[model samples]
Target chain A: MTEELNARDKEEVRQEESTHPGRSYRPDVDIFETAESLVLRADVPGVDESSVSVRLDDGVLSLEGRVSVQDYENLTPVATEYPIGNYLRRFQLSNDLDPEGIAARVTDGVLEVTFPKSAQAKPRQVQVTAG
Target chain B: MTRFRFASPFDSAGRLLTLQREVERASGNPFDAEQSPSGRGVFPSTNVFRDDDGLTLRMEVPGVSPADISVEARENTLTVSGERTIQIPEGTSYHRRERGAGRFARALQLPRDVDPTNVTATCKNGILTVRVAKSENAKPRQITVQAA
Candidate 1:
């Protein structure tokens, strides 16, 4: 089990290294799973719905886009803390995702991705009959 | 009627010019009337990801249609620009306007090298997603090391 976990972790690191080279800007993402679908919410500041993109291909979910900083250009800088850059993040989706039926939307800088679980992947309530 | 005057020497017009100068000084970019027309009071945001096969970009922009958005890729920069016009209901005064309106433009520097000609974008559910296929040189190639 430990070996498997380590292998998975290594694969994740390799995946991340391959996608984003230097800058690491991982948007905050929350994932919730229901009986029918798995929903993912990502918080991307300074991004409009028109500029974001979400896609899934061959079990790999790729998200790429930029965050516009139009208003910050005029404000006087008091202190700098927030790491500002184009937002880029990736997730290696499991086989449970229904790639064809996945849906996504962005509202108020919040991106919501809904992945309906495959019929076989969903938990089944078995009915027991008298034997 | 008599008016009380402050000690400041500049009039309202002068004060406005001073404020504009201050703003320009604070911001590295000079304030241009042309740029102002393109600029809206909204922030730009984008999401990026990649799987084993391809890369995807999801941008958040509400109240924009596919026809209104324009995406162009030149060299290393990918520009996404559009205008979002929200028509407030008649006779309704907005007490609090949080979401921004008007025109917005955002450009992203893709992390990985891609085939500029093959990039595709789709707008659905108010989210614009641009997918760029990794070029043959950029994609990971497996090295078969034969035992020497």
Candidate 2:
């Protein structure tokens, strides 16, 4: 009975490790800040444009997607280090972000998120009045 | 070796021998193909360019998000790694499958000496572009001559 319990515990641990490898679902991100907007780029291989979802709930930005590996049945896979699971990521947005105008798109496995800065956050030119 | 012979009509034991041979050759390794199973573990095709200002590296990685990629530079090498996942819908049968999954890693050696501290990466559309500024020693210098 003890041996069986130990075997089951090992299997559970393996399954947990495979599902959540403790790494970021999206491993790479590039952030670019410009005069008017901030652009974010992420690498999400094996996913399609349609499979990606981007949402802003409250002040948090979340990105989600899925990658399926149903193909290549004929060629046996000798080894794989990648864990398959639902990709998830979240970011806290600053007050300068214009959430209403934020835009996102995915192409060729890369996702780009553009956040336009609010008018109040942009630099303003102050005029001087001569006395 | 065992041999069999066919005899003439009048004399059944008279002989003409027959021989047979079989040849087998192993198939080519699948890794040579552009889209092999293992190939999915690395980033797709990429292009690198160098100019007076900096170096640019572009990789084709579709369907990924900005949060999914990671880039790190150590010594003279830059490493890019990421993961992509897909789920098959229930009741769907796949006729053909080509894309690969899991974690992928790609490392590149810069053509010119770069200031690792000033490296930047940008992704637009489906291309991941990494720009690294060249070190003073690696940048081109123009020399002027003064006539005496």
Per-residue lDDT of A1-131 in model 2, one digit per residue for the tens?
Answer: 11100000000112222232322244355566766777776656555677678889999888866543222112222222233233566678888999989898876666678889899997788899998
Residue B54, candidate 1: Cα error in Å is 45
Candidate 1 C-alpha lDDT tens digits along B44-92: 3444545454556655554556788899988767787777654443443
For each candidate, report its DockQ versus the true two-chain complex.
0.02, 0.05
Per-candidate clashes, comma-separated: 29, 27
Candidate 1 structure quality by residue, lDDT tens digits, A20-128? 2323256655666667777776655456668778978777887765544333333333211133344566778888778889888776556778888999998899999
Judged by DockQ cut-offs, the docking class of candidate 1 is incorrect
TM-score against truth, every candidate: 0.39, 0.41
Give the TM-score of chain A, superposed on the true chain A, for all candidates in the order listed. 0.72, 0.72
Best by TM-score: 2
- Alpha carbon lDDT at B101, candidate 2: 48
